[model samples]
Target: MTSNAPDSVERADVVIVGSRCAGTAAAVPLVRAGHKVVVLDKARFPADTLSTHVLVPNGVSELKKMGALDRILALNPARSTHLRITDGDMVVCERYKPFDGIDYGICVPRNLQDECLVETAREAGADIREKCSVESVVWRGGRAVGVVYRDPDGEEREIHAKLVIGADGRRSRVAAEVDSWTPYRGSKNGRGFAFRYMDDPKAGTSQHEEMGVYRAERTVGLTLPSTPEGRVLAVWMCPAEDVSGFRMDPEAAWQQKLDGDPVMADRLAGAQNMGKVRSTADLSSYYRRSSGPGWALAGDAGHFKDPVTGNGMRDALKHGRLLGEAAAPRLHDPERLDAALAVWERGRDLDTLSTYHWGNRESRPDPVSDLVREVLRTFAGQEGPDLSDTFNRARPIEAIVSPTHLVKGLVAALRRPGADRKAIVKQALGELPLEWHGRRNRLLDGFRSTRPTKTERPDWTVGNAPGPPSYRPAADPAPVGADVPAVAA
Candidate 1:
């Protein structure tokens, strides 16, 4: 194939970069709506990516809505129906509440999941160009119009489109080209992560279909049933500062970490390790501006949170579809398209802000304090809504464990016989600073603006758009992780 001349640029209604979850998802809706959709990715099908790979019920719903769930099911991935969380001697176990008729989580490997999504988009009429690298966005009159890319054959080509969507990962090339890579709000992730697969024929079977999460002094571990049947994904999360040591001897470090935790050790007993451990230390969370005049960012390209919550895949699918739906109807009318994109961005922020902050707090590399443990015990004993609902997005996280519950748990701990009253009081007092910071940040977020300012551009034209609405936390809200005892469900 020869490079196309600049004057012979190809065209499309929507050109999307990155063919994984977000990009493929966005393509389905647009192409089905009768638009010419082009999706590009630098990798071929069945390639792997760094991910925890757990999809809660809401994520399953998203897959079904996109018409891809059946394909995923055919892969024989394990269905996780229950969740178990352990901290010290406190244990909370519960079945996942049904959401949109979905009652289970799926832990499909990224290779299968992304390839399934790409196929789904292709079947829906999107032209998917694998192994195509996007070099830059095409600019005309201050708004994006298309992309300049290198095809797998080493031929350069141009695609001019009414809208360009960036569904690339955290370090999105499209976002960088559009100047939307800078996050407006962010927090340093406190933990590092590592995982590997194991042979577990009993996984996803009777009495073993539950996802296990174990929290120790400064670490967290997870056991999730995964694809190809009879296999499980084992994970370990520790302080970010400790990730370097694992790089030297990942096998030994992973084994030592698992052996140190009796719960993990028990779960992995008799299981055979499948390969070398995979690890990542760059888990910082943030929110970036999602859209502008002619370009939009979806998935981790726009917003990312710590993997501790295991909600990234769900958000990626849901928001990517939402963005496509929002833009499809107004593609011919640039003004309406821009307005719709802005609205979608605002809604995305409002929907995910709390979880973003909660993920940050949960990723902290501190031991679970006694006060928090007591609250967890109380919450486990008397729970109104199923904690699983939080993961399903059926209920707000704050509602799972309210401020009243926190106070009650504290008082109950103080009343227990032989309790260390002084230490309990001291622990509660020590949490005041964190609580104050959470409250203050919530307040400030409510008043802050998200609208981009207008400026003259020498390279292109500009458009006017409305600013996003402020985010207000629920009244008398508890600090991010203090009330949410279950790290993940």
Candidate 2:
């Protein structure tokens, strides 16, 4: 390891690869510790990412922790609280009113979001490099030492640091260099695909009806509560095996299928193409066999569950923070670096498996969907809360995105003012189960994972899917395991 003499000629205190949510999240804490940090990535900021574009309240809180909430709120894309969706029968369920947290997270384009944090890291004193791709891991006695990357100009450089962090996306360059990955699991654990679009907003509606199938049977799409009007944002997930056809005529196929969609068809009528549809076909899940030996993995490097949960970005943030905290003290306790990572892995593993299990099980829920309808049936005309701070808390997205169980799902469609609880009722058809608390997960327990292991996805994992219009934590330290799951992997 290099000397930590404040200004050592040999290296940085930390080296992070990739500058997405995970990398930036880790950079925040590291910079605070005064570590010389270098964040390397192949893509520059302001990238147009294919994400659903809805930030959960918890994600907003994380931004606040990183000192980004103020700027974000000022640039709010659009805040939505309830979701109005029509069944195959053309029966529409009103929005789900969040009984607890912000009805919806402010929706900003992914490109803008990436730029926000990357700039934050630089302001906090991190060396930021774009168009830089890592080549391999530098090691000393099987322990990490630094990283080797190719600069944008195609020149190779060696960066030696005490702690090397690999926050690259799903196809992590660092993970490939390290021989410590476990399979993503079964058949479902293979490649997945996704693509994005800008959308046209309906006159009076703001909170995007980010929609998923009752049990995630197949297609996934959502109309985000965002800007650059006349463009309707959406995404569709498919297996990698079928990507060949989709890539051949991405825009055409996307337009055709979406225009053929019952709900999205009308929404897209006024919206034109804001950008070309892009796809990330290799999206899948995998975990490091170990997160030790002086090296650590964050974000996609550690796990890659399907976006069916809308938690990848959130997982990256939470795990990145945890990894950063564990790595921070290492500048002073290099000998215990391995131990610190072990703890991070244990906690993160449980968290990832829990989310994966539920996400996969929730793939197609016709039975439980009925139960959810029963729940939304409970909060038809009640105003949950009315404070901006109350809506920005880091609560679980379950209450906001419940499956076939559309009660709390619609009733809890928490968003900013414009449409009150009564208006939300007039707009939709169902609710997420209230459970004296929030959405129910028991019906989805078994289906979470194809393997159905206890370790992967647990039962009643997180309690009461937080209420709408109150995203702020009623308590502190961020809900432990309650509302954080929607954002976590």
Q: Pick the candidate with the highest TM-score.
A: 1
Model 1 compared with the native: what TM-score? Answer: 0.87
What is every candidate's alpha-carbon RMSD to the true fold? 8.8, 11.1
lDDT of 1 at 89: 79
Per-residue C-alpha lDDT of model 1 across residues 1-489, encoded as one tens digit per residue = 123337788989999999998998898889989999999999988899988698988899999989999999888778988777888778777788767798888988998888899988899999999999999988876778999999999998899999999998888988778765556556666789998888984664654677888888788898888777778888888998778868988878977897679878877888975766888888777666677778899999988888888889889999999999988889998767876777777677667765766676678788877777777776474323376666667755566656776787788779878889998898878665555444444434432233221110011101111113222222211121122111110
Deviating ranges (above 4 Å) for candidate 2? 1-9, 49-52, 74-76, 84-86, 89-103, 182-196, 199-204, 207-217, 238-245, 250-252, 363-489
lDDT of candidate model 1 versus the reference:
0.77
Pairs in steric clash, model 1: 141-460, 141-461, 142-460, 142-461
lDDT of each: 0.77, 0.57
Residue-level lDDT tens digits of model 2 in 1-489: 222223433477899999988998898898898888999988977786556565655566667777666666666456555444333432333333332343555567788778888888788888999999888888776567888778989987778888888898656677656643433232132334545655554635543433323212244444555654334456655434445656888767776556546566665556644666666654434444435566777987766666656667877887888788777876656556666665676667655554554455433322234333333344334334221121222233343334544444454443423435564564343321222111223333221222323223222211121111112222222221322221111
User: How big is the positional error of residue 428 in model 2, measured in Å on the Cα after superposition?
Assistant: 27
